[model samples]
Target: MAAHKIAHASYRGPSVVKEILYGISLGLLAGGLWKMHHWNNQRRTREFYDLLEKGEISVVVEEE
Candidate 1:
């Protein structure tokens, strides 16, 4: 059997600043989305409760 020769792998990765920037960008994007979802949910919940309080809508139970 012949001996197999091994090859060296030389690859340059991204810089620290580039990695940090990417991390910050992804974090900001996620935070913004989360905040937006939370705000929309809160607003909807408040509106629902307000409508209920104002007698605009109500829960109904029927006897069966």
Candidate 2:
């Protein structure tokens, strides 16, 4: 059998600045989403407590 040679493919794409900027923007977007979710959770918890104070909802506990 004869030996065969394979060529390596080296493809270059976007610039470093563009890639860095894209990464930064994605990070900021994810952070903002996480913050929004956290704030919403806090607001919901506050509202639940307010409802509890007003006796709009009740929790039943069983003791043995």
Q: Per-residue CA lDDT of candidate 2, range 27-59, in tens?
A: 999999999999999999999999999988877
Per-residue lDDT of candidate 1, residues 1-64 (tens digit) = 9999999897888799999999999999999999999999999999999999998898776579
TM-score of each: 0.74, 0.68
Estimate the TM-score for candidate 1: 0.74
- Model 2: residues >4 Å from true position, as ranges? 1-13, 61-64
Residue pair clashes in candidate 1: none
Error of 2 at 37 (Å): 0.8
Best by TM-score, which number? 1
The lDDT, on a scale of 0 to 1, for candidate 2 is 0.93
List ranges where model 1 is wrong by over 4 Å: 1-10, 62-64
